[model samples]
Target: DTAVSQTPKYLVTQMGNDKSIKCEQNLGHDTMYWYKQDSKKFLKIMFSYNNKELIINETVPNRFSPKSPDKAHLNLHINSLELGDSAVYFCASSRRGSGNTIYFGEGSWLTVV
Candidate 1:
């Protein structure tokens, strides 16, 4: 079974539209995260959730929201998508700590036109 998976590997939409990406993990990990990789390839943590609890990273915008239905799934929802939102969003999972190895999904590319 796949350890982590994200739907719609590619998304192309116009600015101001709302979109959401679904993520699921089978690794039985307690912690899951949503990360954004910009055009420069700099990865930044947007949100982290453990056992359905929200752990927001300060740098993320208010327009981005992460929802965790359970320990194994974390989904990302974006509202009023802007041109700046064009980037690759990666869903990751870890055991829940600084020392744990983070496993990433294939990533979903969101392009705002």
Candidate 2:
């Protein structure tokens, strides 16, 4: 079983459309996160959750939201998608205080046209 899994590995949509990427972790982690890697491959943290509580939130637009229904799932929803939103979104999970042993999913590639 995959430790972390995300759906729709690739996505292409028109600008102004709304989209979502679903993620799940079976590793029983206490923390989950959403990270974005731009075309330049510079990775950045968009949001983070610890046991369903919002922890770290970076300077991202309000159009993006991270929803966690439970500790095992974290979903990323984007509204009014823009061309600049195109990138690989990664879902990761880790046990808090584990010292850098986070597991990541395959990543959802979103391309807004």
Candidate 3:
């Protein structure tokens, strides 16, 4: 079984379009996160949820929304997506607390053209 999985691995849209990506994990993890990779290949965490509850949002824009329906699922929605939003999005999972192994999904590539 797949430990972590995300749908629509590739997305191409124009500026201002809204889109969403879905993610799920089967590792029985208590914490999940959404991270974005910019063109320069810098990865940054957008949101982190523990047990389906919001725990961190590192100054993520309102256009980016993270929803964790349950411990195993975390979905990301972008409203009026901009050109700057084009990047690779990754979903990850880890145990709660400090110094736990983190597992990541393949990644969702979004392009604004």
Candidate 4:
């Protein structure tokens, strides 16, 4: 079975539209995260959830929200999408902290026109 999976590997929408991306993991890991990789390839954490609790990165905009239905799933919702928001969103899972290796999904590419 796939350890982690995300829907709509590619998304193209006009600016100001809202979009949501779903992610699921079967690794039984307690910690899950949403990351945005910009055009420069800089990966930055947007949100982290463990046991249904959220730990958000300060740099992330209020337009981005992360929802975790359970330990196995974490989804991202974006509102008022802007041209600057066009980037690759990746769902990842890890045990916790810096000790564990973060495993990433294939990534969902979002393009805001």
Q: Model 1, stretches more than 4 Å misplaced?
A: none
- For model 2, the local distance difference test gives 0.95
1 against 3, candidate with superior lDDT = 3
- The TM-score measured for candidate 2 stands at 0.97
lDDT (0-100) at residue 93 of candidate 3?
A: 98
What does candidate 1's lDDT look like per residue over 18-74, in tens digits? 999999999989999998899999998888998999876657778998888889999
Question: Per-residue CA lDDT of candidate 3, range 1-113, in tens?
Answer: 88999988999999988899999999999999999999999999999999999998999889999999999999999999888999999999999988899999999999988
lDDT of each: 0.93, 0.95, 0.95, 0.91
- The residue-level lDDT of candidate 4 at 50 comes to 84
Worst 10 residues of 4 by lDDT: 52-61
Over 4 Å off, model 3: none
Residue ranges of candidate 2 with Cα displaced over 4 Å: none
Winner of 3 and 4 under lDDT: 3
Candidate 1: count of backbone clashes, pairs at least 3 residues apart or interchain: 0
Model 1 worst lDDT window (10 residues): 54-63
Please provide, for model 2 over 1-113, each residue's C-alpha lDDT reduced to its tens digit, 9 standing for 90 to 100. Answer: 98899999999999999999999999989899999999999989999999999999999999999999999999999999999999999999998875769889999999899
